[model samples]
Target: MTGIDETFAGRKGQASATPGAANVPPAATGARPSETRGVHPDAVAAIMAATHGDPFAVLGPHEVGPGVWEVRAVLPEAKSATLLTGGKRIPFERRHPEGFFVARVETQGRPLYELAVEDWDGSERTRHDPYGFGPSLEQHDIDALREVGSNVTYRILGAQAKAVDGIQGFRFAVWAPNARRVSVVGDFNAWDGRRHPMRLWQNGGVWELFIPGLKAGAHYKFELRGPDGSLLPLKADPVAFAAQKPPETASVLQGTSTPAWHDEKWMATRGEKDPRHVPISIYEVHLGSWARVAEEGNRYLTYKELADRLIPYVKEMGFTHIEMLPITEFPFDGSWGYQPVSLFAPTSRFGTPDDFAAFVDAAHEAGIGIMLDWVPGHFPLDAHGLGQFDGTHLYEHADPRQGFHQDWGTYIYNFGRTEVSTFLAANARFWLEHYHLDGLRVDAVASMLYLDYSRRQGEWIPNRYGGNENLDAIEFLRKTNEATYTHAPGTLTVAEESTSWPGVSHPTYTGGLGFGFKWNMGWMHDTLNFVSKETIHRRYHHHDLTFGLLYAFSENFVLPLSHDEVVHGKGSLLGKMPGDRWQKFANLRAYFGFMWGHPGKKLLFMGGEFGQEKEWNHNQSLDWHLLDDAHHRGVKDLVRDLNHLYLNVPALHARDTEAAGFQWLVADDQDNSVIAWARKGREAGEVAVVVSNFTPVVREGYRIGVPEAGFYREAINSDAERYGGSNVGNMGGVRAEAVPSHGQSHSITLTIPPLATTIFVRED
Candidate 1:
């Protein structure tokens, strides 16, 4: 059986599983094996000197002579020590009294053993020796990690439960190449760094140590002595898989277990379909503030509770997916999870990584996808985080101009560094591979794409080519995207990009950034601005509603009324409308009608559907009670119908990103404050007509062109009484005549409501 070596590399003295040689070293001369104090002075002195750098070199076992062995231990907590295993209790010889024990015994081969100790407090305990095992990871794995560019760091680094020479221990590894000494410190070693110094991975910059007695759920942190041997702050593990809930700030050692996945069927079929042509309506949420247990101090719901409650609500609301705000482990709740300290650990606020996995599985089973808001562009400058790690700028650029994000008071990653790039790439893989998330909505992508983004001219540095682009960040994004898609084929990446930068959702092979979708921030800005104005002054801004069509097909897009719009003192979507209460609800209903009919996939932040009045507060639960009011319930009902309609009607979603699927019927109706368009599916006779009237005056017999001569049903009307409107619309349907109007051969005349939008689909 494999355990402590019982001997250290067969040093010339004695080999022992039993303590005390017949003769001991002389104390006056401090000789190897002369009769004096019953223990060798060299071994005793080495034990007293804790900074030997290699505990395995002198403290464990040694073969001093033929068929003879020596064993030693430096147990600072012990008052007495004994070698106990295989039914033999060999008492140790106490040499020099500072808890140094040495013994000698004759043995033919190495033996499995344990250390028994009596503490100064009169308590006794036994543990497997941590110093006797072989390397926890294979040499090949270490070599892969040293390459730095290879995407296998997650497999080697961090706290891994591994078996070395058949002995189980928690093998800890971290990247701190500039440190002179790195040690593992925890309650096991009385939080003393010198008690268990780690072995360096020789020029690779990684330090590792296997403490056999350690196991999952142990709290630990790394202590590193800087290059010049100056003391820096103790830092949490960058590759830690779980961390103590914040305000605690220590990484918890965890054992990796494969989650029981029920998403196999979802995975097998997602690759065959193109998301651009599918119905995608995402409901963005902040898990902490989404809901709470009011009866229990209004605390956040656990992942299990969210899985049970949130999943069914979204599915019933007809949403295809739920896009969460950043769930990565961040220190500050005020930052809304944007300032992450641990990329690998899921924020322990909700639950363990396993709980998050169950949540994803629940979503998949409910036929809804999950998208995480992944923040890789920058990190918080918390002391125990990646900032000044290893007493150097290991993960970020050394220069403030290049690395600091002035807007966020955070540090930008050094994407040009190999280890940094690999760490990010592997992290993305971990989420997809382990958690089974359907996609990532990459945050702050605009900042990553340009060097001058949000920076004054003097505050930014140009690339090597003397341009404004951030080439290193661009390369890093491409690597991460390629690796994520390669390793998890069905998964996707979306960019929250607000720039004219070209080819964002295009394939990387064609020199594009390789994203599946880009948020339509321009659409959101112009449309919201238009609807926020009074109807009397809205005619001049009619172009705002029609202008987005100019670039609607520019890239695969998701028109987002996201959290960014409602946070940071910006009023709620409902509060942004400038009118009386009735008019306010009408304006919101009409705009949502326009949005659903617009040519892009939909993404609405939490509280938008039910007309949340106050701005979103990250610390507070959503005003779900607002649904009790008719106006709020009306908006909610309208949104629910809009979602169901968008999914059922092929014409609305099948051509959301293609130019051929959309055509204008009344582009020059600004004088009447009206606009109409036809959305077409690939099949003949599949068409949807969208008309919006921005004026407060009802229009009777409003003639709009149709693609074919047939009966048209009012698919949806924001003015319907069920949706809190004035109840004005064509009874059930209208007929198309052959008279030419607005360039189409067929025309339809109908009573259109004031300040509302209506959709009509062909019935025959």
Candidate 2:
């Protein structure tokens, strides 16, 4: 379904108030009054119509004469209103029938007072005037927010519970530049837009109000009247730190919580270290489907519960990091947290924002880093969201071709606009600075890099130079990277770019996108295709095995076997093999062994380590019961060993992005479906030789050349019996002799396992 249709039932690209029209208060008496009085006619009209641009000008206390003050209050639900000072009561004149009441204080100005209002139904209540406070947005903040990107927009704009002048309440602010007026409406005022009209900063286009005595957890939305005086639907705050669960679109008032960050050591050293040459084995996970309580109606684990279970599980698996699919607040569970509605708020699916923060803390304490799959290319066009905000294409572009994403039915962010660009850049910094996430893996980067992505020739608009490159998005990405890397030192930004974009992982100052790493999509595609072919046919397609070496060092690449490979009808990684059960298990092990031994970091999606036979289903937990089988358990064990081996051995990880670190021993033994290579560290002796035989034929006395003459101990053999393999290969180790073979002077003549890959480390 289109995102527009998700919130609005009618009126495309226009704000019509039927569902929200009830929020607008009925008009008061139309008699024009003099402006000298505090309760001016314009203020009354605006309050009655709920379109008064600035309520603070007239509603709050104003010194009408020396030592005498005129106090005005608009309680639309009240029948009579009075001002309450300590031990004294001052009555208010009902100026308009729409609950516009006024009172004059003669003693030492307006004095601290509260409003006691009697409703038409004989209900009386007393509360402090919400409009009595002043606007908190300064001119400097507005200029900085509009000019250069600022990271504190969330702190300034959302519903925040704070003590204002010693009065406790929630402060609400939003940016609706073109709106005629805006108001803070919630259950506190019966969703009446006229009850608490906001103070509009004319130049900055920001509306704000502080309601005293209000607490957090109250649901609220900004009720904006369009520039044309047309009432718009109540919108959820874009910078909201918390939100009500989906299907109920309301931003929640958030309370302050001091983060108990115990990861100072992790943060201190993480920035100084270079990840390119280090072993980073990431386990990509979809939190909702990772596990569930089957007996509890398949409910998902809370953030704390996930910390209890997932933290130890990943640490035990020896993975360096856990990459979670976007946990940002999304309206639909099926979007997998991609089409986010609230970027600042962690999804309420698991728990509160603090709950997610706690989860990160727990992971860090366990020595595991966490990465988020951040989606910034586009957002859902839900009416309450940024789409057509203030009855215009404020957040997105005006034209459909430029503004819309056809494939996803979402709204593309107009990165060229300064406010929009700054808002997004700030969001990128929010997660890293607030929740202490280690890195971001930007999703759908190809779509952002190109104008014609997933579109026909006429459906897309080219750049000023008539090129397909999206210059604005490119600039925005650079800005985001600069902000993230600068603000959150030691954090990483990875790109899931599918195209052959140049210098994607290079430094921004050196003319690049500035991501720390890029996903090796070509390697994933080619290798998965090669492994899917029958053993006899694999000989003809040997280039797939050797092709990745051609550009392995092009960027700091991460060899990903991710969720995209196992979802839909693609089947599991184990299920993708073209072999019987035993052969399938062997092929998977061999493929993983090759992957771990390759010249790059590694990523394995959830359940792929255990040889999950079925395709990934986001609605349910993975087939964990399969672990009871020896083959499944064997696959898990192999992954664990691969991670440990990769971390401990410098040859496997160090200099992974340097061409000098790799040397091919045999690249043209395709007839036997065999390929061998050596990985070297910065110096000699830090080397590992890998040999893979794709067929079920054990090649005995296979003379493989090595650089050094020493005892080559078998580090990992995919065909070992412990890994549920046939155990037909090297027993413990092989000794290399001074002989020339495959261009190397030292040669190791040994038994090669069938349909397996093996790693042999030369002893020191």
**Best-performing candidate as measured by lDDT:** 2
TM-score for each of the candidates: 0.92, 0.93
All candidates: CA RMSD (Å): 5.2, 6.6
lDDT tens string, model 2, 2-34? 110111223231122211222222332232323
Error of 2 at 451 (Å): 1.1
**Taking the tens digit of each residue's C-alpha lDDT, what string does model 1 give over 608-706?**
999999999988899999888999999999999999999999899998999999999998888888989999987999899999888888999888888
lDDT of 1 at 187: 66
Deviation of model 2 at 386, angstroms: 1.2
Candidate 2, which segments miss by more than 4 Å at Cα?
1-38, 108-110, 118-126, 147-149
